[model samples]
Target: MIEYFKSDARLLSPLYEFEPGCWVNLVRPTSEEITHVLATTGVEEDFLRAALDPEESSRVELEEDQTLLIVDIPTLEESNVEQDESKIFGTLPMGIIVLPNTVITVCLQDTTVLRGIAQNKVRDIHTAMRTRFVLQILLRVAGLFLRNLRMIERDFTKIERRLYDSLKNEELIQLLGLSKSLVYFSASLKGNEVTMEKMLRGRILKLYEDDRDLLEDALIEIRQAIEMAGIYSSILAGTMDAYASVVSNNLNIIMKVLTVITIIMTIPNIIFGFYGMNITGNDLPFAYWWWVPVVISIGGCIGAWIYMKRKDLL
Candidate 1:
């Protein structure tokens, strides 16, 4: 999808056609739309297509009059099923191309970072301030990372609570998913930090006083996010290991109980086999000779149960 907007009175209003100082927002643009954007914006084809590649790294590229800033943005993927706990977090490279006449953003999917700007949810967004606009986007990207990190932390807490009396794999699986997300967030945040630092150096993109402050704010958030991701990842790793040990210990307890039960049960069988042996003359004082073995077997079984219980092996 392709849409054009220009800020009017601190709000992004729709535009019928490309205009100077307008924002071109593209989400999974088709080939024809790409061609039209390239023809109209005169941005290099490589710059337009750089973000379309999922594996693209965060970096800044300058060619003559145009600057391409690729940054990793946070994204959430939720499961389709109602009961599926498959909320996975990831990062995608978003392209921000700043030109003298226009500013363009390209990404494979519409993200909250851009959506907030487009919907006027963000404050002080002006398309005409091309450099500041890019900074705002970066700032929002960092904020989104922090927001998602908090969500992950909340989820870890919830799962940890559930894990106390639960022995299900589903919760552990979800923890693993969250752990994987932390890994992704950590790597992406670090990459974005490097890219932002380069921008901060004033070599790739020019920065005004206000824009420099904004970028610094973004860097601070990104750095905080990196630290948060690392902490969460460590906590999650330890939690998983502790739960794994608990599971193994539970299994051992079950096996020990089963072994004790089996040993106790064999007493009756052995007694019956010995009493039923083919003996021509079996002398017993009781009128019912079979009662002797039955009583003995019951006594032996009780004795074994008491022994195991005292040993704390039951």
Candidate 2:
């Protein structure tokens, strides 16, 4: 779908008439719409197609009188229903095409930050300059990463509490999920860092001096997010290890109890087996069968007590 927004707070028609200082946000644009954008902006068809490709890497290509800046934006993974644990979400591909007169953004999925910007919910902006708008988007992306990291931290803490109380497979699975999410976040931040470095050094975006400061701020936020993700990843890894050890220790205790029970039960079984095996002329002459049973019962009790005491199973 294609949605066009102008700085004057007017929503354009679906035909997407070219205008200055307007943002064209496309989510899963149709082929005809793509052709329209290309034809209106006079951008190369290949450049437009490349921007739409999800697998396209982050790069900057300077076409005559235009610049194509493709950046990878981080996005949260959707929760999976089949698995007990959540799955890690990967980065979404986003395209920022800067024409001399307008800036166009294309992505496959709708992002919260973009939505907020589109709705005029973000403050301190009467008009959207191409450079400032891009910087705002970057800043929002970084902020989202930090926010996601915080959420993951909160989840880890809850999981850790449950883990300390009792070690379960589900807890481990959740820890794994959190860890994977951190991994994804870290990777996306690194990609963002690289893209930012290129933008700063190459100066292809013709970013203003003030906007450079904003980019630096965005960079700082990205770094902070990366650090937070690293810390959480470390904590989750340690927690997982500790949980595994606890589980192993619990299993050992259970096995010891069962082993001791087996040993104690074996005494009576062995004694009965010996007595049941009748040899010729082995019977007692007194015919006091009660005494035999009493003697065997005493022996079994003594044996069980000694075994219990030795194994600390009492």
Candidate 1 has an lDDT of: 0.90
Model 2 C-alpha lDDT per residue in residues 23-92, reported as the tens digit of each score: 7777878999998877776767766677678777777778887777676676777655445444455677
What ranges in model 1 sit over 4 Å off?
Answer: 80-82, 283-288
* Tens digits of lDDT, candidate 1, 9-57: 8889999889999999999999999999999999999999999999999
lDDT, candidate 2, equals 0.74
Model 1 is weakest, by summed lDDT over 10 consecutive residues, at: 279-288
